[model samples]
Target: FMMKGVTPGPLLFQEQMPLIWILFGTFLIANVLLLPTVGLLTARIAGTALRLPFNLLLPIIAAACVTGAYAINNNPLDVGIMVLMGVVALMLRRGGFPLAQVVLGMVLGPILEQHFMVSAIKSNWDPLSFFERPIALILMGACVATVILGIIAHKRRLTGGDESS
Candidate 1:
């Protein structure tokens, strides 16, 4: 309907909005089907305390990783890069750097830089103008407040139980 530019009539009420509802229904159905199976498997694993020998597990994991790398393009070189990236992530973590953040930054950095450049050009390089928009300012403020609150909550959790006196 959106693509065709056809608006739903008043009688239909939410025909235009049903796509979102359908997506949510599908998500709920997937979660409902998977969650119980996952929980049962987790319980069974816990009870069995089943452990694969490192020798067996390592090859299985490596095979699966290589398969995934190959699946992307059928290129052995990609597997080499994937292994190198995994090793780099491990080394970075060992060095006290946040590996997840590094990966996220790397993944998003190009897209972010592109958008930043486009927005700056569109706004005539007035960076402050980006925050002048009401929605942008509100979103920025919300993000900052959330980070601050998270920090305070985390610090409190780290400090342990307070005196009840």
Candidate 2:
């Protein structure tokens, strides 16, 4: 997850895997304990917002998004990219495309490419070497299983719709 290949910590504990795991465990515990309260608060706020007219809410949401994008790097190009992406997302939404899939691809694409490139270089460009490791084979199997499940679900949904009609 550390894309830069640098783990930030004190020099004394920099290589302490146990200490790192303990910190992660503490974070997990804290988030788990806080989940219910956070969920309730979010639901309450969302319920209130649900009553607002879309016309009234849209501008505020857009402004907040623009402000957030600008605040990230104080760069106009980032704002432009945000606006462009927003337009694309709106079009995709209207076209009945699942935005979550698009977002997931956008986020995972670079990471996957990076790992693929690194693996290829390490393996002297022998693509089959990627599947030589147990972990890699397991992951590949999971990916195949996921795709099969998705195809089966899609077929069932299509047939179910036909039957219902």
Query: Which candidate leads in lDDT?
Result: 2
All candidates: CA RMSD (Å): 7.6, 7.2
Residues 2-60 of candidate 1 have per-residue lDDT tens digits of: 56765666744565467557768999999999889997888888665437677877787
Candidate 2 structure, TM-score to reference? 0.62
lDDT of the candidates, in the order given? 0.84, 0.88
TM-score of each: 0.55, 0.62
Clashing pairs in 2: none
Our model 1 lands, by Cα RMSD against the true structure, at 7.6
Query: What lDDT is reached at residue 81 by model 1?
Result: 96
Residue 22's lDDT within candidate 2 is: 81
Task: Determine the C-alpha RMSD for candidate 2 after optimal superposition of all C-alphas.
Answer: 7.2
